[model samples]
Target: MPGFLKAYVRWVDSANRAIGYAAMLLIFVMVGILIYSSIMKTVDIPPLWTLEMAQFALMAYFLLGGPYAMQMGAHVRMDLLYSTWSDRRKAQVDCFTIVFLLIYLGFLLYGGLSSTMYALEYDERSFSAWRPYMAPIKIIMTFGVFLMLLQTLSELIKDVAKLRGESLS
Candidate 1:
């Protein structure tokens, strides 16, 4: 592999791995929020924001962890046939199939950005009782999608390198 491609793969993998590790903390945050909610309910002082905040935390966790999952090959796949394939055969198939993934991620990114822009432009707020401003979460979600797109490209590059009998790692 060329130096630039190798660097790109290394950088993206490092970044996603770091982000994913950080995002793991969100689960603890969510759990704490739920525990607080439970305690509040027991005291008859339930908070309106707890449920919504917990949901937001979960969204952040999933989105931010996605690219790392991809890089680590932790995402689920139907492996009845795939498990039996040689690494080179798998890379060949991956190189072809990744185009569909890239296309899907591109469309997802476009929609996410459009929705984020609309949220910012209108100062959108949730319809729930808490009625929190939507832009922050929208921005985060959009950023996550962008990261996933970059990671997908990195995966594609790695697949191509594998096909050429080269290692990007």
Candidate 2:
């Protein structure tokens, strides 16, 4: 592989790792919020925004964690059939499926970004009492889709490289 391509892969890997770790941490934070909210409820205190906050955090976690999961080969797959395939065959199958992946990601990126723009233009906010702004979450979701697209490209490159007997692992 070219030095630049290798470096680009490394950069993507680092970014996905950072995003995934942060999302994992946010899951814990969300759990903590839920626990706190439960305690507050038991104590007769209003945890008015805890549910909203947790839902938002959960959305961020799932979106941001996507690329990382793909990078780590942790995403769901048909392992039973895949395990029987040879390396070259596996790479070919992955490459074939990647087209659909790219298509899906492209649509998701477009929709997320458009929604974010609409939210910003309209000054959209949650309907709940706390009424937090929605644009940030939409933006984050768009960013996540962008990152996933990058990761998909990296994977495609690696697959092609493998087929060429040049491992870019």
Candidate 3:
């Protein structure tokens, strides 16, 4: 592999690792918020934003950690037959599935970005009583999908390299 491509993949891997850790931290914070809210509720002092904040944290957690999941090969798929395939065959199958993943993620990223921009321009907010701005979550979604796209490109390169009998690692 060229030094540049190696650097790019390493950068992507690092970014995903950082994001994954952030997601883990978010989960802990969310749990704390819920626990505090529960304890406070017993004293009849429930926090109004706890649920809303939890929802936001959960959304960010799932979206931002997606690239890490992909890197770890944790996504669900039909693996019963795939597990028996050879490396080249696996690469071929991955190439086919990656095309579809890229297409779908492209559309998702576009839509999320558009919605986020619109929300920012119009000062959109949730309908809930707390009414937090929606743009931040949408922006995060768009960025998360963009990260996935980058990781997908890295995976594609690896698959193609494997198919061609080139050692990328």
Candidate 4:
């Protein structure tokens, strides 16, 4: 691979790793939120935002961590036939199938951006009693999707390199 492509791969991997690690902390935050909610409920002082906030944290955790999961090859796959394939064969198959992934991510990004824009423009809020503005989470979700797209492209590059009997690392 060329110098620029190598740099791009390195940069994306580093950024996603940092984001993923930060996202991992959200699980603890979610747990704390739920625990607080439980304690408040026991005292007959349940907060209206606890449940919804916890849900939002969960969403952020997964979405933000997705790119790192893909980068680490932690995403699920069917192993019935794939586990038996040779490395070159796997690379070939990945190179071909990655087109579908790219297409799907493209559509997802488009829709996410549109929804995020609407939220920002209209100051959209959830229908829950807490009624928090939706733009912040929408923006985070869209950014996560964008990172996933970049990571997917990096994977495609790596697959192509593997097919050529080269190493990006």
Candidate 5:
């Protein structure tokens, strides 16, 4: 079971990395197009939907990278007060924070899924001329939140192992 979980995390990590790169590429392309289109528009060329794509891609970028950020422990932390504590206390604090974070992220997971489902049910699309499906992006947020929850659980296990004087790695 542990091996399976380890494999699953590896797969999710790989998948999120791909998503991150794709979102980056999308953003780059949209920005380039926006510049070109704006220039052409000024010269009486046909207006384009660059702004639409850029907004969508930017949201996707944020949603997709969330899980990767949590896994890396690169998220911002204001631990100055906690850092003064002993090692055992630090572990205790981490465990407590992880519990709260788990709850908060679970809420996000639920909300994102609900929004995605609504979008799908209503066939919601962007108001822009491009009109891409919004449900997919919403669903991505849900997936990312789920990944983040897994990461929190992993952290909790690590902290618990530390409390037990065990190597979580």
Candidate 6:
């Protein structure tokens, strides 16, 4: 194994693992706060914005941590097709898959940006008891899409290098 490839993989894995921890903490906090609010509501002292924030936080958790999941091989995949391929074919498939994901993410980014802009221009707010900022949640879509795109590029590069007999780890 080449030293540089090992170092690069280690760096990416370590950075992503740290990010995963932070995301998990956020998810835990959001859940805890919602439960506490629900309990408080029984005493007629509900946290008015807890539900709203929880909804946004849940979305944030999913999108923000999506790439981390992919990096860790935690995403669902139909490996029946992939398992049949030689390593070179598998790498090619991976490259193409990354391309598809990049295109999909590009659309998501555009749509998310448009939606966010529209919401912001209209001063949109959630139509609920909390009336939280809707645009911010929409803006999260952009961030999430970009993260996915970046991670896909990294994986594609790694696979292509592997196909050339270059060790990434």
What digit string (tens of lDDT, one per residue) describes model 4 on residues 11-69?
Answer: 99999999999999999999999999999999999899999999999999999999999
* lDDT leader: 4
Query: Candidate 3, TM-score vs. the true structure?
Result: 0.94
Q: For model 3, what is the alpha-carbon lDDT of residue 155?
A: 87
Candidate 3, residue 116: Cα displacement in angstroms equals 0.6
lDDT tens digits, residue span 104-159, model 5:
98888889888998999999988777788888778866876776777677667666
Q: What is the lDDT of candidate 4?
A: 0.96
Better of 2 and 4 by lDDT: 4
Candidate 2: list runs displaced more than 4 Å: none
Instruction: Note the clash tally of each candidate.
Output: 0, 0, 0, 0, 0, 0
Q: Write the per-residue lDDT of candidate 1 for residues 60-161, one digit (tens) a residue.
A: 999999999999999999999999999999999998998999899899999999999999999999999999999999998998999999999999999888
Specify the poorest-scoring 10-residue window by lDDT in model 6.
1-10
lDDT of 2 by residue, 58-125 (tens): 98898899899999999989899998999999999999999999999999888988899999999999
What are the lDDT figures for the candidates, one per model? 0.94, 0.91, 0.89, 0.96, 0.73, 0.79
Q: Predictions ranked by lDDT, top down?
A: 4, 1, 2, 3, 6, 5
Give the clashing pairs for model 4: none
Provide the global lDDT of candidate 3 against the true structure.
0.89
lDDT (0-100) at residue 27 of candidate 4? 98
Residue pairs in candidate 2 whose N, alpha carbon or C atoms collide under 3 angstroms = none
Q: Give the poorly placed runs of model 3, Cα more than 4 Å off.
A: none
For candidate 2, report its TM-score: 0.94
Q: How much lDDT does candidate 5 score?
A: 0.73
